[model samples]
Target chain A: MSTRTELHYAFALAALCALDVAAADAPVAPAHPLDAPAALKAAFAERIGHPVNVLSFGFGEHYAQALVQNAAAPDEFDEYEAVPGRPLEPGRPKKAGEVDCRKKIAFAALDLDAGARALAQARAAAAANGYKTPDNVTLGADVFCNDFGWRAILTSDANDDAMLQIVWAPDGTSPKAQELHDGGWRKVDVAKLLAGSAKVAPAAPKAEPKTVAGDGRKRDFRRGIDADLARLEAEVGAPLGFKHIGIDRTQLSVDVFQSANRKRVSTWLVGDDGAIKLWREDDTIPFDCNKPFAAGDFPLAQLPDLVADAPSRIPPMPQAQVKDVAVYRSGLCGRPHVYIKLEDERGYGNVEYDERGRLVSAQIQ
Target chain B: MAKTAVAKILLALGASLMLAGAVAGAEAPGTDYGWPNLTDFLKQLIAKVGAPVKVYKLAMDRDGKVDLWIQDQAHPDLVDSWEYDHGAIEGPIPVKFDHYPSIAALDHHVIELTTIDFPRLPAMLATARTKLGQPDARVVFIELERGDSSGFISVTDTPIWTIALDSPRHDGRVEFDLQGRVLDVDKD
Candidate 1:
């Protein structure tokens, strides 16, 4: 067996022995899962001195090889390989016919946060197994690379209590390998990617989690939501429409979509005090929903005027209260109209009108 | 005739004294117009009940009445709340209290109203008013609570005072520390 396999074997044996001790103590919280493929691709890109899109990676008993294309200069394909204890180095050029670089890759770009979680878990796992973790390797690193792009071993349970056997199968035949192969790859900045991942990595899971604000109670996440949105709008321009608002105890963020197409335009991270702490423009197509809203059609200031006679016009329910009002386009690439919602004892109703205050549609249910 | 003139002088002095008393009442630290402000209400209640085990929250509604939630000193597990409107105190009513491990471990929410400096409230409100730049801006609500933006959590023992205003932009919530230091001011 190779030295790398022997090292993994020792770790497996140590983890098995430590399992009883771990069980005796309070149960450790589950580690965040890591993205093995993304880390491998990042490490590979760093070694090759170019951002690369990895197509397929194959491992043998002695060595590992990856077929990749330069992300910057398309059509410039290369193959890299590494043996145990050595970093990846260019093995055969794609033009030499020795390496077959396919255009298709199975996975997308990696979520760097997952990578950070992986790193943390790996470090914990190493400490648990009584091994001195290397500084260069990430915590809970699912994939281990040699000095360069020469060799790597991918394992699913590297950080698990009883370390699973490091699968050294050939030609990516394993089910896990196949799944990774089918997932295409994308280019990324390894340093920034790792740093961002590290920032979001949760503190090593404790036997007892630390108490955060709003513990043991259902917190009103929207306590200052309006103030936060207003602050965000003051900083960035008004959003076309809200695509998503993620509110939890630890974090709050709003995904804003702009333009008539309603493509996601930006994201705003909100602080506890309802301030826009950070504003990040949409770097990727996170959402593609075609629902469009004309944010400019009717400002909130116009709602009072538009719904002046709304209660009188909708006679099905008396003493109806205005609940919500929004501007929505009829169809993709259609004109914007105001939709006012009213609620009473029976049910809710919607009253629609154009910007010119012309009644368009009214439905009660 | 000379004795009558002396009597008229005495009457004029008495009227002047009454006017001075009225001016003093108007300028009282927490008196806003003819109504008792939030600080005055809190001071009266705290005097009657003593320092609470913990103060959960306090808020003023549109009617200018104040509602307070405090952990009952007699029963640590229970929360006793009250509503104050127009010089009337209407409760020692039990309220929803969620047991929290953090709060139980450390009584971080306990507040000694007697020790708290409440006189600086007017200045703080004035600062917020100047920042808002709205001539008609008025304090719609005020609260002393844990967690600056969210609901309960043992974030700090130093209680926070949030004053919300009904402004044209609707961005008029101001936060101040117990000592009246401005913590945050939402943009107008």
Candidate 2:
């Protein structure tokens, strides 16, 4: 080997040996003692019905300490120190102070098994170099965000060599996070981990509400009264006045004046469900208008055509002169119809046509 | 070639150590020289099972154990998986449909596992290490599909090899293609 390459390999092997020493420092018993803290977390999550933040976990030869915070109530937490195969020591609920929940440990992303194996690789490399691993060496991982929003730090305390320090940032593409990645720090796949676990996935972006306009364009309907009034003009010939009624403001009433007499010619009642009804003055018998016509009660753009063809659809109501014409939806039958008022010096006669302007019925009173 | 020989030597060393039970059940045993051994295992696998019609996924865990999922031609809905650990192979284990995610176009996106250039894997891994740092956990190879904004369209022809780094960088992954070309670097 060249001098530089040998030095590089030698340094790497030495670092690996130190990492191995760190892995061995943890209490040996339950096959994987480092997993004991995560097991406690899993058990606690099972009890709470969801995963919560683990503020800190301290390892010992026989017992591990964990301080966990409630996910719902972040300020509340409990601290427990427990041994393997034994119940957690009882802990009282405590309040969080000066605790940034954002930096809480991500237990799902913490794989101590991998950390130990990496250390073992380091040990093997050291063995190949014929170096004796120091007995007093210690290695550990601190899996929590430090200053950055990304959680988890897989760092070793072996002679300042940050071997295999992995950090998981939500936005892995961030420059700082990427810098950490370039600096020998591995990034955890939090999305994939959460997918395999019971953790709730991140909220999806809100979808835009779909809208249909008379012009076949996605026009915003919430653009104040002028736009709404303009939309209503397509149904009624220039509404003179508009007002919302009913206890819950679920009804809308509009007055239309097409003639130059300055008198209201037609009154239209629209239900919140998009049902429409029309009323005119000097009517003899009240029409059956209980059921309101809702959405799919014919398009508003077709109203002008229906009104214009109403006269030709029926014969004059028994030689009666046409007094006034009004268009409305027969809410009781859920159909749009045009009502033509007629007068023959007696009282008033009426003729009605469907949305297609086909004559349907006639009545005299 | 010298580096490859060194990797082979390390593989032998790891194998002997594993056989001695010194590093058995260790997550990603012999990670320092795991890539060459994995490629060697895959080459042997193709020789044993022949070329697969569709390769669902190939994954190596922290324990240096490899799992390969290939579609069964006779039963199109079932997938046959083979696991390799410590120089021993286990199973053509049949996995039912829906147990794992399915590709949108399985027939069109066939990964010719047999014809893959196994010799280039070590170099590709070295490039990944240089560009994106070492992987602390596992390596995964799967075909990725592009999902449409409407959630109704599927485009599943992209194949990628992901080198997942250890904790904290759990999201960090260095991506490459079958021909050992670097596709993406880190946490993609």
TM agreement with the true structure for every prediction:
0.28, 0.29
Fnat, one value per model = 0.00, 0.00
Predicted model with the maximum lDDT: 1
Stretches of model 1 off by over 4 angstroms after superposition:
A1-365, B1-54, B98-106, B148-157
Q: Write candidate 2's Cα lDDT for B2-45 as tens digits.
A: 45544554353344323323323433442453432554555456
The digit string of per-residue lDDT tens for model 1 on A266-334 reads: 666655544445455563354344443433453344545556566666775467666555454544435
DockQ of each: 0.01, 0.01
Error of 1 at A73 (Å): 48
By summed lDDT, which 10 consecutive residues of candidate 2 chain B come out lowest?
B142-151
Cα deviation of B22 in candidate 2 (Å)?
22
TM-score of 2: 0.29
Q: In model 2, which regions exceed 4 Å deviation?
A: A1-365, B1-33, B36-48, B51-53, B99-104, B133-156, B167-171
Query: lDDT tens string, model 1, B1-188?
Result: 25455444334334433342233225343334222354445545655565432566777664567687776676564456788885678778755323222335324455644334444555666777766554445667777776622234544535788877654333477888877888887753
Per-model C-alpha lDDT, please?
A: 0.49, 0.45
